[model samples]
Target chain A: MNAADLPSSCDLVVIGGGPAGLAAAALAARAGVQTVLFDENAGVGGQIYRGITATPVEDRAILGADYWAGVGLVDEARASGAVIVNGAIVWSLDPARRVGVSIAGKARLIQARQVIVATGSLERPLPIPGWTLPGVMTAGAAQTALKAQGLVPDGRTVMAGAGPLLWLLAAQLLRAGAKIEAILDTAPRMNWLRAAWHLPDFALSPYWSKGLALLREVKAKVPVIRVDRVEAHGRDRFAEVAFGSASGERRMKADLLLLHHGVVPNVNLALAAGVAHRWNGRQLCFEPVVDQDFGTSIPGIAVAGDGAGIAGGTAAAERGRIAAIAAVAALKPDAILPQVQAIRQRLAREEMGRAFLDVLYQPAPGHRRPVGDTIVCRCEEVTARQVRDAADLGCEGPNQMKAFLRCGMGPCQGRLCGLTVTELIAEQRRSNPAEVGYYRLRPPVKPISLAELASLPISDAERKAVER
Target chain B: MFKRLGSTGTEVMLKVDGKPVRARSGDTVAAALLAAGIDHCRTTPVTGAPRAPYCLMGVCFDCLVTIDGVGSRQGCLVPVREGMAVETQLGRREAGR
Candidate 1:
């Protein structure tokens, strides 16, 4: 995308090109409303459907049905006549529906009548000891590489932590012909008892059959260890992973250590835009407060997809359609959206058994709140001890801790460390995560060069306000 | 530690630490680096410890590398271009390049 190709203003601007944004943009455009979608990646598919248009992998069967389902989304979004822009880094979105975006290092501000943020989710950070080593990466990273580049880990690989996605990735990697050494399951066995209450709904849901098949597929090939404690051991790059189970302590030589503990709503952009958010104890992260229509506290802005909450990709698309229908109705008050009810029905079905998955996958307290010498903030290299010590000194919340220890002030802007720091503080204070609160995020949400800001066209009124 | 499962038809060349590395057309700088066996992209600014791309989705800054003439570019976000120059960042950005 070039700077000149950008619009000065638009009817509806959708940020993120995931399942939610794609569905929303396609619906809005098909409804005769002018819509523009911006995605940071070179391709339109968000992480779940990454490389839908440009994947290098020739054998489509290896990626499975769920991964290829994104093709319809990309096709519909492209055919709907929405102005879709790729390689667009949206840095700022204000309460007034003004968006600051950069393309190819050129910046522009566009005023939007209605905005839909469908930024989706990022993998929860697993901050075990030596996790910052070179060979250690999030499980999502491996999936992205495989989906986009047809690359696989050639060396001995050991995946730690537990979630539905972890098993899915293991299955995908094995199908891709990648070698795996072991899978260290960090999910507490007792969670099964707590999650049993929701078993009826889960058994009826679509995930039951697919999850069973996936687990069976991976379990046949890989050594699955139910470990209570796990850590990476390496000097410069990852060389091995160690885990302690009911039997005893054991170690495995590994060239790659993929870590996962489920995903959380990526709330930085929505939070920085002044949307109301609360800590979701069940999901163990902060999520934007949204109503049935997916509308945010800001009148014209809406949040959909995993960014609103951690529903899967299919549910996210339905949420996006609902939000888009609401947007069309708001922009043109007389517009009739007969499909709204149908979309909601689909969403309810898609969201079936989500509670069971959430309860089953909720990370243990120890994993979320690591202690001792384990590094909490990867950017600042601040250890868990330092954060605990700061909390003991009466550091109120993430903001005060940032001022005191510079934990969330790094280049990543608290994306990697905010949840860990909040949990650590909450544990130390014997308070809940909600009371501890999250970092007060500000914009330029994604980093932008100073030169990009300097090149923006300025007006006399703006200049006078600053000059005085 | 990573290998390409197949080719994407066209291949491009990039310089990682002043050495030419062959990369597929659609691969990001980070993916190309990983395939070329360059694990760590940069050392952290605070302690100068080696760090690699943790989250390839642009959330983690561990993939920061010097691209072209600019410093601290997200290698995972930037697609590998033909004859692009990528340097491993040792520490914090040097003053004025």
Candidate 2:
């Protein structure tokens, strides 16, 4: 936990502190391995359970029971004696199991025998025009603001997007005293058609009542606006929004415009580490390929939690535990059992609820690959037309487009544009997203100061090895 | 867009561009600024247009600001301390001491 005297190596280096990372690191360390978990946040709750440790909201009702569910697991991890280093950003990972990290601006390199990446998911790229305007942000952003800092959206606030999180956020916002505007639902029609067939399955699942209740509450107070298409419009800050609803094109003025299509696995670190990933059509994002053991394509590296794929916090914790048990077995064969029966039973139950949720919350089809001057890349302000032109000019994928139009080469590092870029190229080339491929991710995954790099304490052995 | 939902935490005083701003004990620099009616956090490097804390979770770089003489720190991520000085980030970072 000492940034000044950080270990050059450890047994396991779990790269996130969300539900999965915390579970994996805690279990692995308790199973007799030197495990250290690094999270960029000051606390351990990943995005889903963000600010659980430091949530300023005294009334937990504002956050709901599902969010509070992870509290026990977080407490367990905190008590498990795993070295939890918050505010430690892992910027790079090498094949040799070396992790480059910045802990409160001090840089260090930690080598590990086994690495588990449970970095978790990010809000999907909502590339509607004027999305980059000052007041426009993701639903997750607004939720994080409320949860982490107890700040509520003032003025007229409009919530737009699909999924349970969007509704949950709306409910929480209403409780926080945010002014009413409308909830523009961009959820795909196919989900509604498919949801009924799977409704029985969802009802039987444990999360059934919770999800339904959230939906009911949001629908009760807020005026749900179903829009065929939605776009934020403003010059300095988002002043108004234009969208086509059931009636026709309409414009509404709002102060804060929060947008969320869905979430995607945060795979920048995984891709940079050369972990194999496959495009998940249902989720519409690339998830790292992991076996039942949660081991990724590379040996000594396991991926768990929503970072591997978005299964939410509960499933992520189960996946993390499964990965930890498998990791300990891999490292110290005698320590693990032939089969973790109880854990498997729990995991099975946790997984049942996920299928129906994923099906129901998938982003609307049109929203994924937007049309008509929609800005695909918010950082560089690249449009769908420009990306198609790049493809027409023989640009094969995101990398080629990067060279051709500087689409994915921005400060946000394609986080807001990677998926859209891939889809755009895929559409133009008459192929699928997997065929078009994703941007070649590199590290420092998050930015690191040049001064911090220059100040890394080179051990005597490292200096000697470098000379050779 | 900002309002404090609860008053459990103690208040702390900080400065934004030499103006004293009051914030709670656990409030982030971005939250304090937003609560104080300061909408624009920084201006874009290329277009020179204003930007704010779009993503409070440190993912979006739009909340970049100079904190305690350090440049390009995401205002949402940095917890506010008493008497801390924060300035709007301008363009690319200069190596700060």
Model 1 per-residue lDDT at A239: 92
Residue A45 of model 2: what lDDT?
Answer: 87
Which regions of candidate 2 deviate over 4 angstroms?
A: A336-339, A461-468, B95-97
lDDT of 1 by residue, A1-468 (tens): 586677789999999999999999999998889999999998889999999898987887788999899999999999999999989999999999999999999999999999999999998978888889999999999999998888899989999998999999999999889999999999999999999998999998889999999999999999999988888998898998999977999988989999999999999999999999998978899999999999999999999999999989999999999999999998987765656888898899888889899999888888888889999899898999999999999998999998889998888889889999999999899998999999999999998989998867687999998995
TM-score of chain B of 2: 0.92
Candidates in order: C-alpha RMSD to true structure: 1.2, 2.0
**Model 2: how far is A391 from its true place, Å?**
1.3
Which ranges of candidate 1 are over 4 A from the true structure? A336-338, A463-468
Best by lDDT, which number? 1
Candidate whose TM-score is highest:
1
